[model samples]
Target chain A: MHAVRNIRLCTKDCLCLYVCPTGATDTETGQIDASKCLSGCRACVDACPSHAISLIPAEFPPQQEKTVSVKNALLTLAASKMDQEEIASKLAETTGNPVLRQLAEALGKSNRLMAEDMLRESGYMLPQSRTVGELLESLLSEKQPADFPEAAVKRLLELVNGNTMQEGKASAFEKIDY
Target chain B: MMRKFVCGICGFVYDESLGYPEGGIAPGLKWEDLPEDWICPLCGATKVEFKEQETVIPEEKKQSSLDEEHQEKIRELSFKELSALCSNLSKGCEKQYRNEEADLFRQLAEYYDSKSSAAFEAQISDLAALIEADLSSGYENANRRAAAVSDRGALRALTWGEKVTRILSSLLSRYEKQGETLLANTNVYVCEICGFVYIGDEAPEICPVCKVPNLKIAQIQRG
Candidate 1:
């Protein structure tokens, strides 16, 4: 779903290359192949800053295999970046040592870099929006339990691993994974 | 040597070395050399938006955009705007990843934990919390803090704080845009029969393109 960076305005940053998980964007072609892209993943879209990239949804029949790596990458990037930022700020507030503060800042910068890479490599296309727009939209559209209910997660795990439940309390419809 | 002009609206740069062939859409092309039918190589801004890659200094015109003294109308940041934010974030993050030398930043960290490893973990966690707040906390939440900002123009103009906030907004749903500023999330419907997309909320009984009645709404899905 990722679009190509504007060569004229790219600044040759290579952030997109680092963020990409599948290496789908590593070629000299500099453009993504639609067929290799995971269905509905929008990682690279969220990473581009030049507004050069976009995600075009596959029309007609939707693809069966949903490639979730992009989503996974975003979640990890967001979580890690957010973590480093919080840690850095806290250390800055409480610690007196300038060294600790500097380390925190470094961590923060790394998270930001990873997030950017994810956005550049993320390849989802939404109309009138860049790749990042599509990725963020997907984040909202996709649902998670308790945003992370242990039981819900377990059930999903069960589904994925072919585990059978105790057959009580929750109905089959409840088994429907978000 | 090449002369270039950057498009503020779209991050497109026009390089005179490539010389658009009388072409407006494609940069680095001569307006005269291009084929008559050749379209823009980028976003297809058409020929009109291209301004001269000027050598003269038009201080007033140039400063207007960068200085931005006048408050922007603050049109609701649309899903379209999200693209710009995310792409910018990509560039920013990429810059971070490539940073090998831990200069002033690493020097600031406290490495005296049980070990350097633990110290790194603790530090990362704290940073994560700060970013989480930026991404998750609403404008109203910021308002409660007495430092919260609601105006898009003011927020957009921020140097450091708003950069994170804007990035946070990029992660948020477009539906989160509340108040009158919201873009109505509007889209025009186009009739396949005549190929007219209605630009407004209500579908007119007659088609704008073919005057056809009860025209089927064009399935124009917004990204």
Candidate 2:
């Protein structure tokens, strides 16, 4: 875990600067330098006056698979938001009045953002994540339609495989050849 | 006499014009006339969880349709409501042990809450202006926060959000610049699964973001 500072609540007390053993908190941008900070060392987190700092894990575990019910609910909500966005976009396009058009555009944008948020929450936005990779793998292995974008899936697999190969090479290079 | 009711839990809007026949609710049925035990057909949320669409006025009373004051009020109320929804969603993510997803929701909640303040500051009655501010802050914060945590899923989500925001921003700007000329030439398709918007003559064979087939992409018609 590394300490992070929420600049919003930082009071410029400089307490973190004084107590840090590695001087990771002594930054001009009010953000803790994660590299210099010791692992699990929360001296600054404890000493901060405004409670602006907290420890976040350096590595997060793989996300758990969402239940079918939750996934269905999220997709439904996403579709509903898309419907609202479509209405707002159409209104924006059709309206001649500048103010009304602007308002409609804003509505469309907000609805789209909300929909994207739900997509992220439902685990559909992470194409490069393990779950997504696994999903793509399964899809590719199955009997897919002729127009199922097989090339895209293959490209994704290549990227994953390339990453694994690079990592393997790096580990091999780290070994001391006797 | 038709009014819209929005589900607080899922953002589902029940339009009187297209009454939820799936829920056995007949067309033209007033929201008040619905049974006391009625629930959201989509999410099963109780009647109490449904809020009337605050800014929508009847079509016959077109003159009373969203004025500046009403627009500002609705904008503020919508931010508050969106924040509440984010909070609920974060709790749900936490229940599933999806920490990164939960964190993203918390960040979204913070962004929207802060945006409500920005809206108040700018007195932005226009929804597009509010959304611009939202996307600007959302991507910036997501980039910064995602770096501090090593969640690949969170990072990918943030990157995707940024890309989509950029596309939408450019599209909206083009619409603003060209007006009806642009609208006349192009059609808008929305992905029903993930809400990815595509603007062109036809929908893509597959969604670039969600990878869903074109069947899930529905064209948004302009009347």
Candidate 3:
């Protein structure tokens, strides 16, 4: 997930802190846990006063099907080392703790696994009401979930169609990882 | 006529006209109006816990909402009644952003003018009670929520604590406006494949260093 904070502009009014469900965005630190950020529930994107935050993508081609079933998706997630070190360094610099640095390293080892988990449980992929094609097209390889869960997709249609579901507490990464 | 009284504790508005109490409106009511179990939906405080909204009886009455003679008597209300009225005035004062504490007191005293004795005392004791309930209940709720969300053991392991750093970085960064560079005293990092700002010393392992296959070492200076 593309979780990064544009710290240079944030005001520290804590509007984001107050609003974030997972406390992913801390009022005091202005850093968001890249790992904990919801797959596409960009709550901080709008709550940010300075507009200093944006989510980026992990893999390039996203080689698996846009909506790969749980199993294949898991394979791709295991492949990349990604920028785990740079992100770890930044986090370590901010936290001044080696535990998170070590944790980040371990997560890097499992980034693909976590990503697959995020994708599998991602509401976009759940298909409670939608088709595979509809779900696949909605994944934002680009920055915006803009036109996300394409209108053609049934499951994508469900947030508008389904009963207002309580947003689940943990995302896929939060679920199994715990 | 019905008035909407907003709760100081929960901001829940009681629109007396809305049949919250099936029977009808009663001023200074403790009757069958508000449901006995109608706790604050947000925090669950009972109806008995709430008092009717405070009325800030005007100080030097010129226009009479009441008959001329009655208005005079209201103005001449004893010190105790007057103090109780002032306490309500303070509660009824509109809460605003950036308002000073002294201004609230000023607004409170603005009621009941020279004819009213400054020595007036109505126990205003109810004021203490309302405040006590709010503090006791409010702080306790906050504590419970804080505990529910507290990260312990491995749950703490997965967290990024990125929010804390982001806040400190913003606080530390000297910028004139959002997204605009002030001194540009920041670090530069490149996506090896994509060229996104690494914003730090070394290149990110993945092409979130998006420009290069593997990152190249580079330094950025303000132009």
Cα lDDT for residue A115, candidate 1: 35
Assess each model's interface with DockQ, reporting 2 decimals per model.
0.05, 0.02, 0.01
- lDDT string, candidate 1, B1-223, tens digits: 4566543223356666665545444555554544533323332223333444665355332111212312323222222223233334333323323122122112112211111222343543344355555445422222222222122222221212323333322222221333212224443344433222233455556543235565344434332
lDDT-based ranking: 2, 1, 3
Q: Is candidate 1 or candidate 2 better by DockQ?
A: 1
Local lDDT at A178 for model 1? 17
User: Residue A45 CA error for candidate 2 (Å)?
Assistant: 0.8
2 or 3: which has the higher lDDT? 2
The C-alpha lDDT values of all candidates are 0.37, 0.56, 0.34
In order of DockQ, best first, we have 1, 2, 3
Instruction: Specify the highest-TM-score model's number.
Output: 2
The recovered share of true contacts, given per candidate in order, is 0.08, 0.01, 0.00
Error of 3 at B204 (Å): 30
Docking class of 1: incorrect
Error of 3 at A9 (Å): 2.6
Error of 2 at A75 (Å): 1.3
